[model samples]
Target: MQVIDAMHKITSHIRNPSKFSKASKLALQLIEAGSVKPGTVSHFFAILEAAMSSPGACNEPSVRADYQALFNAAQGVTECFNQQQKKQFDIWVLHAVVANDLFTDDSFVFSKAVGKIKDAISALPITTVDDDNDEAAALAAVESKSGTTHNNTDDNAQAAASNSLPDDSTHAAASNSREESSDPFGLDGLLEHKSNKSEKAREKTVAALNRKADEDESKRFLKSQREALLKCLEIAARRYRIPWTQTAIDIFAKHAYDNMNRFTMQQRDAITKLWNSIKEQQIRRKQGKSVSGKLDVNAFEYLQEKYSHEKISIRHAVGGGGERRATQWLG
Candidate 1:
């Protein structure tokens, strides 16, 4: 169910899949809204089943077929979560399915699969919804902050309505009377003017639209960055013949973000650099076991040849009392 577990099972079912190529294909499938169109939970499960059943370590044609199918399915699952605004849900569902041992459980449903997040959301402290009093209080607080007095608008209209008018401007009094009489809340009857309804509605509409656009843009940008990071991780996984879970990739992403100006650099560069450093550390650890008071270069080359497919050549020339021993490694 965890990302790593999914990755392992997936990797085991494919033979040398081109993860970078798959990433490119999946990236293009992203819609203009910036995510893959979501699939139903049933469809997602079906894809998972296909991927799990696919053959691994097959002939070239079979490998490509398996890769394409699995890649498509994986991409589908990723997009399913994303388009639905469920970031990281692909990995979450994988982990959940695994943890619940639901692969063989025919009775499990999608709602149950997704209920964990629902519980978390319900538990959040900010999720407070109550009766109409709370809504009224919220509205009142916002309205109070506008700084315009209720009397400023309708009160003036009322005053105008009551006043004596010269013959030339009789229409102005009539217009004020119509406006005051048209007040739906009857605040004007009390000689109090509320804000302009049409103007306030227009402002609210514009503000809401702007806020939604901003939210969408921010989500798109974040998704793009995360996709790029995931692409790098996938490439690394395939290249090194290693499996990665989401948690592991997340840790890598965290380190990469911390060190690379919060992922402003190309993600592949971080992946490559980190991979090399890790390999160097592993080599050093391995080399640590082979060290003794060593002087027999010929014997060392012999051992290297014996242990590896590649030949190691170490030449010793009788010069300066046969102390000159040169070593060269060839692949």
Candidate 2:
């Protein structure tokens, strides 16, 4: 997966150098008070950030898929979410996380503890953001619902009162009356619903087309960032006359991509980790270390495992056809 590209929209929104520093502070407080794992906190942030702007983002299937994918891709660090944390995630994420736990219902005290958080998420934003088409749609919806609906409701109530239907009737008659009132021309209901469905579908297709250009731009931006990081790694290896294969570069490139944000801090961290790996591999070569150390494998795998405490390993081998192969440890 191209991690950098996937995260560009979210990371750009955070707009800060430090990786979720504000959210991390809140998460630490939760950890000290509650008993969920540290990884859970990161998962919470990811769900919240996505939920802020994505429909069905908090749904069980979508949330679970994202959780699993990110856990595997991050090697359990939740690095992507960490890089893209926003202040908005602090409340919505906390509510979602706590609400997911079964133990929250264990006691009355737990009820009071999460009561406020629950209320906070209840009034979730209908549209947290959209720069163009989404914003236009939202505004149109608000105008349609708020402005015209109010006048229509007033007229409908007066008309209903003036033309009150007979109440004394059979139960079957009352049922038929209710159904007729709802449908009016009967086929009017069917046609209205069909038209509504078609309109919504058309709007969605148009919106998707509108977003395609922006998506392309984001991919280009991420590609540039990826190339820049890869070039830095190339320069570092060349300085020491090390053989940095394109395959190995692709491996470490992904790792660096995963942890990177547009922030200066993330860039700095990548460089530090890259340099440390370079130096470590040199020492390993000088000492004629383990099989992993002797081979021209990925430096990122070693760097992340040692410094970040992620459970990770990368294995390189020769295929039956003499092509290079590597096993990736996901989750």
Top TM-score: which candidate number?
1
Candidate 2, 93-169: lDDT as tens digits: 33234323212223443343234333432332222223233324433545455433422432354335324422223
lDDT of 1 by residue, 52-97 (tens): 2312221134233333443434554453433322333343233323
Give all TM-scores, in the order shown.
0.24, 0.22
Model 1 lDDT-worst window of ten: 310-319
- Candidate 1: regions farther than 4 A off: 1-197, 241-259, 264-331
Residue 231 lDDT in candidate 2: 34
Clash number for each model: 7, 0
Q: Pick the candidate with the highest lDDT.
A: 2
Backbone clashes in model 2, listed as residue pairs: none
